[model samples]
Target: MTQTGSYLYAIAAPVGDDVLGGLRGVADEPVRAVRHRDLVAVVGTVDIGPDGPFGEEALAQNLSDAGWLAAVARAHHAVIDGVARAVPAAPLRLATIVADDDGVRDRLERWQDGLRRTLDEIAGHAEWSVKVHAPQPADPDTDPQPAAGAPGAGAAYLLRRKAVATARDDALARASAVAGQVHEELARHATDARRLAVQDQRLTGADTPMSLNGAYLVPVAGADAFVATVEELRERYPDCRFELAGPWPAYSFVTVEEP
Candidate 1:
């Protein structure tokens, strides 16, 4: 037997024909509305065959599979990319499928005004991510002193180790102070800012410890200015590594409307 799924495009306010014309879903499918009184859910049809993107077995397999995870991520981006061009949208979590159109309508009814306001607020803005990494300092190789009698040498060695640890701690504290300054300066230019969990140094390519991993929502007109501000920041903080990426879909900023 063949199964089916509702592929959500986005949750948006009730829009006119002109706005709907500009929106598309997976595979360039024209967006259609499933209305629930005050709110509307834009969606397209998706197949749920054995080999389809959201098939029951396929979903289960992705629970532990890296390749499956990547494919799903791409599919999600494609859908969001299309709709965001036309409307202020809150892209749902990946694979947020429902049984059919009725289920989509039910969600719209439950979250109407919150969805409307979220869409209005985000219209014409995009999300950008920036992170700062503090590079690891080169290890200072200290020679171990030989013990005179051997039995009491362990106690002396520990004392020397403690002194070295104290010095390193002082250095880390200074670096952290510098990082804080950078975050504060950058926050001044953003409409909204959020500090994300520190990513691994290896992934971030920062020389110092990661000082900041943050997301910002900036107006489209201010995008160039935002990039320029970040460039100036990079020039100002030559001692620290600054990594910047995005103009991506507003993943972190979007939230369900509250009653």
Candidate 2:
């Protein structure tokens, strides 16, 4: 028998009954809200039995598969964004599961006051992601053209390689310094800021390695200003490109355990 569990995504206050009408969650199951007092928990059923996609038996394997993780994350974010847009909420950690709706209600009741305060902290803010990348050296196979005044072989080639290495190091150092400045500038206009670990090009789909991966909690009212500042950053750092995404569901700003 396939045993199912309730997966919790976010918590809000008295969410509209019809808010999740057409929404789906893990495994494409219909989403519903579990309520206790004046609070509601957005939830959906996820199988936790052997052979189930999200089952504990296969949890490690599933996490190792990038495609599966991405699909699930997308679904989770879609529902979270929907609820956040309609009303303020505190997004739960990824893949938080409970045995059933009763478990969901119990947990919500236990954490009611703390969770409410978490919601209040992020009431007027959304998270925005910013990344900066420094371009990599041109590929030799595809371009076949090295920097002007190229060295063919022998002593000149060795010296050229040494110089190239030094230049690359310098560029990376400069990129790091600039990334710090960018974060400081953005943080000035944000309620709070968090510097996430830099991401690999493979994960970010960027042309160069990332120097900064930051998330800023910008007020909903000041979202336009945040975006404008990002544009200014783009111009300010020509050697390193900047990318901005979201008005995301206050994911980075809320913690259920927070005071």
Candidate 3:
């Protein structure tokens, strides 16, 4: 027989049973609500036997399999994303499972204070992702060089190299400054903002280099203005390309304590 565990997707303020009706979670299992005090946990039953796919040992191995990870991640996020649409939800890390409802209650009871605060913070807000990519730095033109072993040949070569390096450095510095300006301007329109690490060219699959990867928490009412600000910045700074995606759950701002 497959031993089962409760796979927790998110925590929210008092979700009614009717709200979760017909909703499915990980493994295509029926979603249910487990309440503790004023908070409710969104969960689904999942197999976690010693040899089951989600068994601790097997889970570690499965995470390394791209296809398996992607499938599970999609399912997990789907549940959280759905719940978040109806309530101020604080999502748990993917694959958070416990022994049973009692365990889920224990987690809720233990984190009630923090959970309530997080819920309050996210009640009327959503997360937005913004990326700023700059055009690739232009290659420098080379000046005709003196023949090797000629007088002052080495000196001229050293001077040319130094000039090229300085020019490249200056270009990068300018790009960085522009990125900072854009982030600052956008922050003015957001309730909270986070600057994430820039992605590599290979990961972005773009010829241009990424200068800024940012997350912002904005009020639902201000969402339109926030998007407009992004568009405005795009026009104001033609040298940098801006990409915006959002109205998602406050993934970057939610401070849920791990079980």
> What TM-score would every model get versus the actual structure?
0.76, 0.87, 0.88
- Ordered from best to worst lDDT, the candidate numbers read 3, 2, 1
Model 2, poorest ten-residue lDDT window?
Answer: 137-146
lDDT of each: 0.72, 0.85, 0.86
Residue 167 lDDT, candidate 2, scale 0-100: 71
- Per-residue lDDT of model 3, residues 21-59, tens digit only: 857876888999998898999999988998888889988
* After superposition, candidate 1 runs with Cα above 4 Å error: 13-40, 47-53, 138-175, 202-208, 257-259
Model 2 lDDT at residue 56: 82
> Which regions of candidate 3 are displaced past 4 Å?
142-168, 257-259
User: Tens digits of per-residue lDDT for model 2 on 1-259?
Assistant: 9899999989986778688886888689988888898889999999988888878868779878999889988989988988898888888877888899999988888888998888888887899999988756433333244555766545555666776787778778888998999999999999999998898779777776899999999999999999999999898877788889998988888766633
| lDDT for predicted candidate 1 compared with the true structure | 0.72
Could you tell me the TM-score of candidate 1? Answer: 0.76
Better of 1 and 3 by lDDT: 3
Residue range 43-145, candidate 1, lDDT tens digits:
7777677977568887777646887677656756766765676667788887677889998987887777677767777788888888776644534447666
